[model samples]
Target: MSGSISRRDVIQAGAAVTITAAMVSGLAERAVAGPAIIPFSVSVPETALRDLMRRLAAVRWPEAETEKGWSQGVPLHQLQRLVDYWRTSYDWRRFESQINAFSQFRTEIDGLSIHFLHVRSRHENALPIVLTHGWPGSVIEFLKVIGPLTDPTAHDGRAEDAFHVIVPSMPGYGFSDKPSAPGWNIERIARAWTELVYRLGYVRWVAQGGDLGAFVTNTLALQKPSGLIAIHLNLALAIPSPLPTEGATLAEREAITAMARHGTDGSGYFQEQATRPQTIGYSLADSPVGLAAWIYEKFQAWTDNTGAPESALTRDEMLNDITLYWLTNTAASAARLYRENNGHGPNQGVVAFPVGISIFPREIVRVPRSWADKVYPNIIHWNELNKGGHFAAFEQPAIFTQELRDCFRGVRRT
Candidate 1:
């Protein structure tokens, strides 16, 4: 097959494949003959680093909000402090080293060069899972869990619990190529992911995602692609068809209240990005502090923090993600995803495949089981986490890893 072969081409060819070292070597040879799975390493240019620092030094400050606390948005004092730390203390090389420590690669799927971290387990019969990250988040969210997931034995877990993990940067995010056309919506991303897994030669696999990643994973389950056995989601997008009446239960009332608050106060960025990504993109692309504050505001609001985002994520951790967007200059392109997929939600009725959901208390909307059951009928596993919030993997990696291990225990192929 040629490098331009579609995923359908590979699936139609239908060859049984395993992930042994020898098999990987054979696959590498085939990659050269067909579409090349090139080994990828990240090296940010010194010129870019200098430019980022220059922009940071020359940031134009905005006036403080009239409100006392976060009722308005990220405070000026807090943002200045964070910006100072990011400029002086945050180390981009350290973050780059952490990512490059893993086995990373880029391969063309659906006419786009997709960047992904492909870490295989040493354990026998390890389950394969594709992890998708959301907006204001990159593969950085999964860095903490990668070691625990891929090498369970090393992390005080049995080898049988190990997973062959694939964390991909969605199109227009991180190192992945930005889409120039207008057709790259959530469903298109789902198709790309289907092709990605099949192209890697996996016959059976599971998928896990949170936020926008959850949207894509749920779409995958809805599509019922060939190799996808099951799916686990941190953010349940299963909005019931014909919409249920509001205030049915206490939980439902709370969910409605929370969603209402977000829609009113927290959706400014959402609206702008969905309608005029280019307008905001200019600010994000040009100003480093502007980019930092834009993303940092979400970290503050979405996390399980009481007063500040620092209560949940460390300064360095937040900077690592923000720096990725700044260095890659992907702020506008990433924002365009919202425009391409405006008003997209879960399909009505029950998804046929096995679905697992983990609910965090402080998620944008704390979905009730009654509401979720209307859409996800085959919910084999459902857990309400006592702590954590929207960015579950980033805030609580240990709990997130365990959730996946337990949720997929029965779903894994023998």
Candidate 2:
């Protein structure tokens, strides 16, 4: 519990295992194994990044009329600010070094290069916490919280609360390898993660994730490995059950309506990525602006930030993520994950695991608490927050951390 992730936890990152797995829903108990040190890397090349910046500066964007806000795409003014900073001010090497500084590495899992940051706490009582990131978000979302989660004592917390954080780039999202074959659904990733934590030598641990990471964590929770005491997720409503036949509460009725509406608009990316990720990936791979537009739009729409995306995060911070995609040329590979996972991945069953869910206001987690409680029979924590939207980590790390600490409080075992 005190050390960073154990070297043995690395599996010889799997080769693309065929057979697309349905989203795992049925509840089952599983075993957690430490991964063998499957060699992995998160480093980006120097020349590729420089060329990406040059391409961004010379991008020929179609200007929109004043009437058209950011509805269709990012405005020229906004893109210029980001691109200008990317060309002159943003430093990819610095960000790369910063991310790698805290024990970053990759392991081939299911034939994909899974990039992850394993930060161990110096405290004797550190809890092993696995943090997963969602779609349109790389490991950057957890960057601010890594310090707080790994060294809570330095951040004015008790040593008992320290976390040996494992932050992985979802397959195809960052430094992780893109899936070449079918399958590689969220549940498989969860299974891979179950092995991942056990390999670290922790007898019992907790997991937390938001967005796609949330879905992955949800599957991990559903698996309910022997060492998995509990799982916490920012977006916790994925498994859809029969709607409440028992008359709906005001909140539940409203939530039902929201879920219906979300299917219409909130899920555009899922459709494109699930079906035609290669097309979108090719476009994004060739054009840096396209990649920014695809990923940046989510930052604006999903975040609770105002003024500009820059207001919530420095342009450099945002570009650092986009730069990773541009340099790695993994945009297409990243999109292919959607093809592999589909909607909510494989919807297998009703899990009775001890799951805790925290819903931020501006998210698709409109499923009422009653609905959530039915699937997670052992839910012990539920929170409704006002500050952040989808990328809660970046929007409100302090709040997110506190909520996570509270969710898994008294649940870890060394």
Candidate 3:
């Protein structure tokens, strides 16, 4: 109690039960208003993997006019090696078990079959937390923290810090179905999640997200949906009032400089996602290697990893996330999120809801404290993490868990 809440606090909340038989039956017997999970198992079939391997092997990689850096496209040789591992050793079954280790369930909400992991707290009055993952990430992103956050019994804390967590696979990603009609933007997804928690009978809860998830949580906070409590995010992007003046603090000046440089260099993925998801969709859809390169590039850029992506995340973990995308065939749908949320309407400026900003050291865009304060007027908690990057939960669960635990302290829910 004297120091900032530790992982021990979660373990100290004491044993408590959530999702009682009544709650479970109520959920099961509830009206079939949402989409029902068609009884099925995920599989790619042997023939399919082999076919994809053949395609990757047979790709007509064009010899670059010059062997300059990766300015043109994924370097052919580098991609092939990663592809080879994917074809031979990348095991989806192992990762699937890793994913299913948490409580996995699928429910149809608002005509969409949504897949989510719901981990209940051990405390009688535990807070409900919804964690969202952005593109190029799956629920696998949070597998590292699930134990510490949900079952603090093993962490030397009690259940009060435990959370009834809901981590959903966004529509058009993972096991979720592809969008048949248009307009499944961040706002739409936020609305769907809003409907989801409300129907589950949760009166109040907090939202935590990163990458595209940060954007979605921002929308949820802005929309002020009923039962919404507060929002916490690991990634923050700020556009200063007057850009950066020479008189600005060093951090502010650095933020401005970073904005100028990353805005230019860090925008290719946005361009592709916004403009031609379908044009590039074929490569990712057909070639596992191509998908690995595309996703791997982000891991390299966003992670704390050095030159080699494997330095931050093992090849198995990295490929596991990629394999979900490949088997689910969600490259274009995931990409279209950019296209759908483009030219935002409600999500353009600062949100009014209470917000907690957690700053990780190696995020692609790090907002200066002075800059962040200006944007998040309701910022009650601000922290500079010791370690981590864009993929906070997966790369560094301890830091991510602590940041969220401290940030959401005293945050009221609906």
C-alpha RMSD values across all candidates? 6.5, 7.8, 9.0
Model 2 lDDT at residue 157: 73
lDDT of 3 by residue, 5-64 (tens): 212221112232223221321123233233333322343455545666666567666565
lDDT of each: 0.83, 0.71, 0.73
Model 1 C-alpha lDDT per residue in residues 132-236, reported as the tens digit of each score? 999989999999999999899888787878898999999998878888889999889999988877777666789999888998998899899986888999988
Q: Model 3 reaches what TM-score against the true structure?
A: 0.86
Deviation of model 2 at 187, angstroms: 1.8
Off by over 4 Å in 1: 1-34, 241-247, 346-349
Full candidate order by lDDT, most accurate first: 1, 3, 2
By TM-score rank, best first, the candidates go: 1, 3, 2
TM-score of each: 0.91, 0.85, 0.86
* Model 1 residue 352 lDDT score: 77
Which model scores highest in lDDT? 1
Each model's total of backbone clashes: 0, 25, 14
Q: Model 2, 93-187: lDDT tens per residue?
A: 78866875676656556565567788777776667788998777788889999898888878867776778888887776666666667788887
